[model samples]
Target: MGVGVFGRNHARVYQELERQGEAVRLVGVVDSDLDRADAVAREFGCRAFGSIEQMLTTHSEVRAASVAAPTVHHLEVARALMQKGVDVLIEKPLAASLAEADELVQLAATHKRIAQAGHLERFNPAVRATIPLLTQPMFFEVHRLSVFTPRSLDVDVVLDLMIHDLDIVLSFANSPVKEVRAVGLPILSGKVDIANVRLEFESGCVANFTASRVSTERVRKLRFFQPQQYVSVDYGRQEVLVFTVGGDGATSGAPTVNPQIKVAKPTVTSEEPLHAELKSFLQAVRQRSTPVVPLEDGRRSLALALDIVAAIREHGKKVGLAGLAKAKS
Candidate 1:
């Protein structure tokens, strides 16, 4: 795997897995910035390429790629790799638009190679713990707020931060979104840095989500309520709080006892999900099995994200937010 854009982190993760006798190796590092390239390559004892073309031309053993390039460059770079028979695990949001995502998905299908999305939350232990519990969610609520970070300004909060929640919500419901409503404004940044969205799903599940890159504190959580219980999960803290009826007569109608709250600390192991995700992709390639987060899933998330962005724009117009600054003000 070639570390693209500060992708030495990918190299580190893979090397750590290799140290554990896992099936991953550090092939090389690639960067348009020669200095960054040389620095990371020297540290990893691997070759460095200033361009994807050079990497493809020079390294024949490079079978797969983890695309950590910027969003705008994702489609172009990943498509080229796919054309060359290299599977790609692209960073989240897939691409800037649904159209681009579609193209990449088709290319992967055409080539019969892997095209996985880096929605690392799919592998998150917190999410994995909650997946089985979310059988029939009546209502879902998510909050993903962080003290303003300098990363991911190429797009707004919807695409940058909120899409993670959106993807998770969609995955749980496994239903089509019926309607979307959103409000966003550029605060602290010259783009839509913060936003709130509501999504209506056909399965009678409604989701309210709020995301902001401008905040004093950080929080990543999701809450879901059903007929029998309410679940509050702190994804940031890896904590789950389940309030539900207990005892044999619990489901006998008369609300048996207080809601049982279980705090299941999942044996804090050093199993990084991103590393697991990357390993899964590699294993899929080696086994010719399906990737956990396939390209189609990424496409669906991108499509919904674009709809939310459009809804926010419409909200802007409704409130007479004709200018970006006015919306923020």
Candidate 2:
């Protein structure tokens, strides 16, 4: 609803879908800043409003909306929409806290509204391709790095970046986290700019994640090891490379580095993840079916991200990071 950076993208995708003759229409865009909302509305040929109240009142026909407002405002915005019988696709880090997330769950249940979580990576072709290859992931190494940006400074790297990988790993592992250890530092913003986390799941799966907003080059990759297979997923490139041991390597069309090892690239249909996610949300709203990435999944990921943040803070205290920063200053 709020036409900020991510919100603008959501608006654009909705407009594109409308152009493609999707059964949906781009009714309007909303933002706290009226000027920004007006600009986006003009660009997308829709109406604009300064607040959810104004938008909902003006567009009572609005059946569904995307809540791309600030993380702290998610519950408020989604609550208003859901109460009005509007389904919602809420962005990641679903709510500011667990209590708010729980309330969102309850509200959706009470209203019988279709709610989806905006975990964009789940719609990535690479991630989709890796799903079938999942056997029993024992270890994982994930990296999501980007050039520094002032956007999303309201949260630390754990929430801003690492949460994507967290959601993916959590879904892949399908197990409760047994332990978490993390360390992070604020390089350019008051919030954490870089973080490294180790998560051990109840299924004996260990995952190491490194997420940074301050990096020289961008990298988004996840590599995991299963029983006799290793899979690599490139989020940006939308590619999946699977290496299996003791296979014929005949069907893969990829050269075998070793005689016993086989490499196969799963076929992935390239499509904008936002487009796919929105399409899925709309389908769920139409058929009264559960969304692929539901609000419960968002809450689960948010819980883990919050836990990692807490672990990082504890580690900082143990290592006297405050003293080190003071000395350097």
Candidate 3:
């Protein structure tokens, strides 16, 4: 079942798959908006529930669910579904707070249900290709700046955009965070719409991240400096450029360090990451296999994002205006 506002996409994708006789089917939908529920139901020829309880009660064959509600509702919906012995795949940011995310993780464990988080970038072919080249990354930088959109006006840029980079960074290491420095500003919106974060890891890895929703052009890029090699990833263009430091075509047998050279600029085909993400979620449920991005992973990412937000808020003290209330004022 697809629950809540943005979840309509989930139902549509399922219906498309069923049209092609795919393994998944559009069993039901649950949305807070009655008109939307009814319209979507008519389009897909599926039942529309006013609440998750009504959906679960009516669809006994619904062994799995995809939770696409707002970030705040993620925990509530996921916990309820897991309690009903249904595997759940939740959208990004996991939950509004880490504490709530942790509760969902615990619920999944107690109920023994497969719980996955929607960090769809994992399915991006560019990201998948860069994963192997990320070995021994000493320095990483990510920037996700896009033209302002009101679709996610409830929160700031960190959770809205940078969480993708945060999730991707964590996958590269097992080291704990040593320190974090951040700052944010609210230009047009009541909340912080742009932010920058610098993270230092215990293993000497450093990552600089920036996100903004008030940009003239859309950009999604990540650059990594791993040892003597440098890799630049342009996710939006689905292209990767790598540079490495090694010996040149010289007869000087002194093994002298050579200038950096451009490595293969691999061409990555463009594909919809969300479709692959949902497909994997269904496959995981069917095979009883571990989720590619598990609930615990979501919990950890939310925890880090919360920590970054706190640091940015505290960062105001450095500029002598400690309590600048921009949002919820």
Choose the strongest candidate by lDDT.
2
Write model 1 residue lDDT over 221-268, tens digit each, in one string: 999988677888787776677777565655676655665544444433
Expressed as tens digits, the lDDT of each residue in 1-329 for candidate 3 is 44445577778777777786778778788877767788888888898888888987788878888888777788888888888899998999898876788788889889988889999888888888887776698898899999987768787778888889999888875688889999888766767788899999999999999999999989999998886688998878878888876665323435555554658777687877777787888889989999999988887887888888778777765675434343421
- Better by lDDT, candidate 2 or 1: 2
Per-residue CA lDDT of candidate 2, range 297-320, in tens?
Answer: 999999999888888888887888
Stretches of candidate 2 off by over 4 Å are 247-259, 323-329
Q: Per lDDT, what order, best first?
A: 2, 3, 1
lDDT of 3 at 10: 79
Candidate of highest TM-score: 2
When 1 and 2 are scored with TM-score, the better candidate is 2
**Ten residues in a row with the worst lDDT in model 1?**
261-270
Inter-residue clash pairs, candidate 2: none
lDDT (Cα, 0-100) at 130 in candidate 1: 82
After best superposition, candidate 3 residue 91: deviation in angstroms? 0.9
Error at 230, model 2, angstroms = 0.8
Candidate 2 global TM-score? 0.94
- Candidate 1's TM-score: 0.92
